[model samples]
Target: MQKLIFSFLMALASLSAPLQASEPASTHANITQEVNDWLNTSLSNSPGAFSFELRPIVSRLKLDGCTQREISLPQGNRLVGNTMLRVKCIEGANWMFNLPVKISIQVQYAVAARPLAANQEISTGDIAMQQGDLATLPGSVILDPATAIGRALNSPVAAGQTLRQEQLRTAMAISQNQKVKIIFRQDGIEISNEGIAMNAAAEGQPVRVRLDKGKTITGTAQLGGIVDVGP
Candidate 1:
């Protein structure tokens, strides 16, 4: 009687096995598609044209079937450099994946036409346009020639070197100890006063000025040695 009961239980277990096997599994193609869709959206607003390719997915790895997926780049990554994109199943499964990516971005930037000296003022002839991948270049590379022209370089630049925004300085609008016109406007009324500048400052830069009565005030330097005393 005991052997008969054991045989009956084994038959019932076999009948339920098919249901578990049919539950489902995640496929490699679906995961790769999700990554491609996400990458295209993230780079849509970049300054220049870009392209990316994902490394081949592991074929033998298996995970729970995913109904929904969450994709993101690691923090501090802009998705332009060779980096890893993370895919996590937010529904129907609890698995995460990291896929390697190869990126190529093309952007136009200014490069020095010839060797330049420190403190040399820039002109239109000083630089030429060049194109390269933004990921491998400096973060602050100057893309517009207008931004670099008329500004003085803080350090020497070799020919073919990329021009950076911070390497140039704006022309000074006010000289130290120079007399400047102080302008103040309120309710459409304008007032003009004279002050002695205490320090040299470039346009839009703060400068200290001493008034006639030995008083000092801070104001922004402007064109023609004018100091804007009020908004």
Candidate 2:
């Protein structure tokens, strides 16, 4: 999962030169420190707070420790709950083994404060903040309430349901037949005019409008029903 991949990348920074095969392999205490160090370093950028526990290696298993080796995790899976890391020796004895790690990440995500109907515009009161583990929730859960505000839902959301980006629709900044302010700038000269939108458009999307003079122009849509044209 993401946590393991991140730790593996940071592991590159702490890698040391291979020691002689006769040299004693890394101890459990050493691994605990190294693993925890990288795990803390890389996960600091995560959107939520996290805690992890490194499972103890069996004393009976005489597998070579990673003094100079690569640690990787299975792909196409999120890094949470119970997971195993593959540690392969690149120097000394040719050996490989698996180490178990458990991760828990708690994030503050947005959820519906009340039952919301489809296409209903979202307001501050419509969403409430909830704290829970990321693994138990939808991957695309919205973490910011500002992201949901002013947007309409694609389907009805039950109260207490976690909000996701895919379930919401972005509010259009332009609408057909609506009067939109148009701005034009060329050769350092700027002018403003008004026009009727020929088609609906979202912010930053192209829009066509008919001016007072019966001339049509294409421009980039802006918020507040404004459009920018001419360079």
- The lDDT of each candidate is 0.89, 0.82
> What lDDT is reached at residue 100 by model 2?
83
lDDT of 2 by residue, 1-231 (tens): 999999998777556433334457667666566667766875688788898888876777665544476666657545666677766777765777778888888999999999999978899999999999887888799998998899888899999999999999876789899999999989999899999999988788899999877999999999999999967
TM-scores of the candidates in the order shown: 0.76, 0.73
Highest lDDT model number: 1
Task: Write down the lDDT that model 1 would get.
Answer: 0.89
Model 2: which residue pairs collide? 1-79
RMSD of each: 4.2, 13.2
Q: Can you write out model 1's per-residue Cα lDDT over 102-212, one digit (the tens) per residue? A: 888899999999999997889999999999999899989998799988888989999999999889999678889999999988789999999999998989999999998
What does the lDDT read for residue 38 in candidate 2? 66
List candidate 1 segments past 4 Å from native: 1-23, 114-125, 146-152, 184-196, 210-218
